[model samples]
Target chain A: MKTLRLLYMAEVKLSVREMSSVIFGILLPVGLMGLMGMFADTQLELIRAFAAIATIGLVSTGIMSLPLSLSSYREKKVLKRYKVTPISPTHLLAAHVLHCFSLSTLSMVLVFLVAWLGFGLEIVGSLWLFLGGYVFVMIAIHSIGMLVASVSPREKTTGAISSALFFPMFLLSGATIPLTILPEFMQTLAQIFPLTHGITILTDIATINEFNTVSFLILFVLTGICLMISVKTFKWE
Target chain B: MGEVIRVSGLTKRFGQKIAVQDLHLSVRAGSIFGLLGSNGAGKSTTIDCMLGTERADAGEIRILGTDPRANRRSLFQHVGVQFQESAFQSGLKVREICEITHSLYENPIDWQKTVAEFELSDKLKTTISDLSGGERQKLCILLAMMGRPKVIFLDELTTGLDPVARRDIWQTLLRLKQTGVTLFLTSHYMDEVEKLCDEILVIKGGKELIRGTAADVVHRTDSENMDEAFVKLVEEGIR
Candidate 1:
């Protein structure tokens, strides 16, 4: 736990010091949240129609931000440096996932605040359940990010790959569109992704207390499988 | 006495090109060992194998009397490695790098004293990215020496440094020898091998051409200088 804290502090300081990433990772998320809030009244009907739009934070950090961070570290040999040291890969990987988790949580809070203050949105769900589902979604999507980073040829290519994977997940996960109105094939394809299950369950419990045991089980299985594969396939150098 | 490093019948092949072939060596504690080879002669490959960064095709390697294949993390705790390139986060300060490395080892050298010895006290807070080539090399040595390691591996240690820095590092290596640390170093600079190494292994075409003390190898070639001796041995092999 102490080692995890040390690694987290190191990664956070390094990330904060890098201005370009800071702009995208921190400022951009806040800006996008604000942009959504600015039109929340007209969009409130649309957003509240499918409350999963609130999970844009999870997708941004997990699918886009985290992969780029890991890929960049690989390119810079930070991961390789850790390989030569006494640090275990599991600890390092845990630190990375924890860092992404914290960042995504922060982004979610910002978006929630904007929605509440601007659009008079109300979160009617159990806070603990929302947090659990949020963390699971972060872990599952961050696992995909690690998989992409491991396969990317270079850090420069991470952005293109992550962006390519990000938009579809965000749109189809009910962040930008309502899954209820989509065709059955699209919804089924989206269900294979954790974002759909995560947002669906999180919004259901938060707004209506409509818990689906099947969706929760699907999330657990997907998270378990991806976490195993990411841990097995991740390469430092 | 523990064997610091051992390799037997180690081979590395890159597609059709054989980098190292049928290599066998044992370095004992408290001795300075050298892997002398010219460009692309597979010195780095052998070092990589011992470091457990790359696997040997057909041989066994034990670092510090433990199989590196099985106990990489356990052995790594007592080993310090300096690569040829400036292989560090350049944006990090020298002091920060030292502190971070110290955290990794069970017993680390005093950072202030280490920096003073390297004449790097003035550059403690300076970012590695802003350092000169010689300064960066000194920083690398400083980091490698910080933990008072049992064994140190240096690959092409003086490649891109000025003469003064190279001489400073050689003097430091001699000091480290007095403290009874095993040193396994690879270099194309024959002069460096002659000055610092207690024993040298000359490798060419992925095989050992000769292995002996500096004086013994020079005497065998009937050459006054180590450079001329190396050339004579290589030329003889060509014939």
Candidate 2:
């Protein structure tokens, strides 16, 4: 327990010091939401933009930042070094997950604050439902990130694979460009991505006082599968 | 003195290649033991197996009277290891790394004292990415010693240090020895082994080629120095 706490504190410090994590995880989403607020002419547009900004935090941290850090740790043999200590590899991995989750939560809170203060946007849904969906989305996305980190042989390869996954998910998941604007085939294809379900769940809860039960179930199932595979395949070296 | 490390018939294989084959060795308490081998000679593989970081195909290892694999938590509480290519997180400061490592053991040395002893006080706030090679090696030593371990493994301990820094590290090791800590070290520098090791084991092709006191091995091989004895033993196939 003490070791975990120490590791968590160290991880938090390291995560905060990383400039790219700060830029992508916090700055990009909050900046996008602030920009959207200035141009959104309708309450619905503002709400959708706010919801999409929230998913941007999730996807950016989950797909881009989290895997990159884990793979870098592997590449540098940081994980291997820890294996010789009394601290278990599981503790190190849990610390990183908790650190990234906390960063994601902070980013979402900033997006909410900026949208509510600057754009006069309000969530019309059950706040409890929104929070619940948000947690599930984070779990699903982070699990996918862990899976990617575990399978990639090196940090550079993880970066390449994560970027390949990130851009398409960012564009077609109704985060940047709405699903209504996307071609029919693209919209259908987006359904295969966890990010699409995450954004849809958040937007539904924030706008309609409810969320899609199917998306919630799908995301929960995906989280379980990804977490299992990642744990099974994880290598300290 | 009780044996701190005991290994018998240790074997490890990677797919088709044997990494360590039928290896056996022992180290008495409070002694300095040197392990030497050429590249790919299973020095690291043996260390990995002994440290419980990798599984052995067949062997029994009793480290401090406990199987490292079965009792890792207890084993690690008393053992410290410095790997040849280990690294801390690049963004962590020297002090932050010290603090985190300090928390891992039940009884750790004072972090400030360790930093001072290692001449790392100046690098306390420096991130790992900004550290010089010798500074990084010093940090590794500081971390390994922080646990106040009963047995410490140092792999390529002075690989990147200058002569002054290497001498300082040698003095530190000698001090640790005076405190009754068992040292298991590997180095390419034969003089380091001659100066520090009470027992020396030279391996080639995953098998022991020579084992004795450094001077005894030199005398047995009829060589003038450890380096010459090492080459003669390897060339003569462990006679």
Candidate 3:
């Protein structure tokens, strides 16, 4: 327990030192929501924009920062160094997960606060459901990032692969453009992305006071599958 | 003194290439044991297998009378390893690295003493990326010794250091030896081996070519020094 706490503290320090992750994972989402407040004339539009910004924060950390950090650790032989110590690889990985989760929570809080103050956006649905959906979305996206990190053979390739998946998801998964604005074929294709379901559930609960059981189940199943694959395929070096 | 490390018939292969084959070794407590090999001679593979980082194809390894594979946690608690390619995160400060490593052991050495001995007291707040190659090597050595392990593995311990820094490390190592810590060292510097090792094993193509005290091997090969003896042993084959 003491070792885990020390590892966690180290991980948190490292995460804060990574300026790029801080900018993309926290600042950008809050800034985007603040900008959206100017153009959003209705409560529905304001809620959708805030939800999309939250999704952006999740993706930035989950799909971009998490995999990049894990792969870089492997490339640098940090994991290899830990293998010789009393601390197991599982402990190191757990520290990383806890660090990323904390970052996600901070990002979420910042985005929510900015949206509330700047645009007067309020959650009309059950707060418990909204919070539950947010947690599930974060886990599902981070699990996918873990899967990518585990399968990538090199740090350089991990970046290329993560960006390849991230850019498309960012552009089409209702985070940047609403599903109504996308072409019918694109909207249908977006359904395959976990982020699409995440944004849908979030916006539904926040704006319309509706809960979509199907989307929630889809997010849960995706999280489970990705988590299993990542654990089974993880490589220390 | 009891044997701190014992290996027998250790074999490891990477696909079609056999890295180490039918290897056997033993290191008595409180001794500096040197392992010499050409590039790709399986020195690293053997160390990796003994450290439980790699599984051997066939062999038995006992470190302090414990199987490294079956009792890895307990084995690691008493063993420190410095790898040739090991690295810390660039963003971490030297002090932060020391503190984190200090927390991993049951009874760690004083971090301040380690820093002063390694000459890293001035660089405590410096990030890893800002440290020189010699400083990084020193930091690695310091971290390995922080646990105060009974047996320590040093791979290429002085690869990128100046003569003065190398001498300092050698002095520190000798001090550790005086404290009854067993040293398992691998180095390309023949002079370093000749000066410090009580027993030396020279290997080629994953097999032992010769093993003895440094002076004994030199006399047996009819050479004046370790470099000459090593070349002759490799060229003329071990007699």
TM-score of chain A of each: 0.78, 0.93, 0.93
Distance from true location, Cα of B210 in model 1, Å: 1.8
TM per candidate comes to: 0.85, 0.96, 0.97
lDDT of each: 0.75, 0.87, 0.87
Candidate 3 chain B: minimum summed lDDT over ten consecutive residues — where?
B230-239
Model 2 iRMSD vs. native: 1.2
lDDT of 2 by residue, B1-239 (tens): 99999999999999999989999999999999999988788999999999988999998999999998898887788999999875777788888888889999898998898788778889889987788777787788778988889999999989877888788788888998999999999998888999999998999989888899999999998889998888887777644
Question: Candidate 2, A170: how far from true, in Å?
Answer: 1.5
lDDT for each residue of candidate 1 in B1-239, tens digit (9 for 90 to 100)? 56778899999888898989999998888888999878877898888887878778888888888876677677778788887765554456777677777777777788798788778899988888888877787787777776678898888888887788788888888888889889999876778888888888888878999888988988988889788888888777621
Tell me each candidate's RMSD, in Å, in order.
Answer: 3.6, 1.5, 1.5
Which ranges of candidate 2 are over 4 A from the true structure?
B235-238
- Model 2 chain B: ten consecutive residues of lowest lDDT: B230-239
lDDT of 2: 0.87
Clashing pairs in 2: none
Give the alpha carbon lDDT tens digit for every residue of A134-229 in model 1.
776667677778778777878779899998888888678776666767998998899866778777777777776667678878877876776677
